[model samples]
Target: MKDGQEYLLFLTPEQDGLFGTRGVTFGKVPLNTEELEVSEDQIESSHTHTEKLRTIFNEGRKKYGK
Candidate 1:
């Protein structure tokens, strides 16, 4: 997803990563910020949001003791 271009992610109730066997993969995105309007700060912010999601998943794992 681009920094400025908005998008929506839909997650089903059963698809919750919490307490599940599903594995989460964090991919490495290679982008050239010079060609786009997106800035390094904006990209960092987006990654921070994903970090929060990872934190949530970690918490869920702890809670479920999975």
Candidate 2:
């Protein structure tokens, strides 16, 4: 990678280190594309946005512990 280049990473937690979705080949993708595709969708949530975030954080704390 060059000095100023940026990339998007898809990673999974590992005991040794984070690994890509499918080994090194699927690790990262360059974000320097001329045209990038984006899509937006709306979904219903049981909790308010802040409450949803708090719920997520609480779940993480349960998994990894505080």
With a 3 Å backbone cut-off (N, CA, C), the pairs that clash in candidate 2 are none
Candidate 2 structure quality by residue, lDDT tens digits, 26-52: 233445542221212222343474455
**What is candidate 2's local distance difference test score?**
0.42
TM-score of model 2 vs. true structure: 0.36
Which residue window of length 10 is worst by lDDT in model 2?
Answer: 34-43
Task: Tell me the whole-model lDDT of each prediction, alpha carbons only.
Answer: 0.38, 0.42
Which regions in candidate 1 have their CA more than 4 angstroms from the true location? 1-45
Candidate 1, residues 44-64, lDDT tens digits: the string is: 557677566556544444444
Candidate 2 regions exceeding 4 Å error are 16-22, 34-66
C-alpha root-mean-square deviation, candidate 2: 11.3
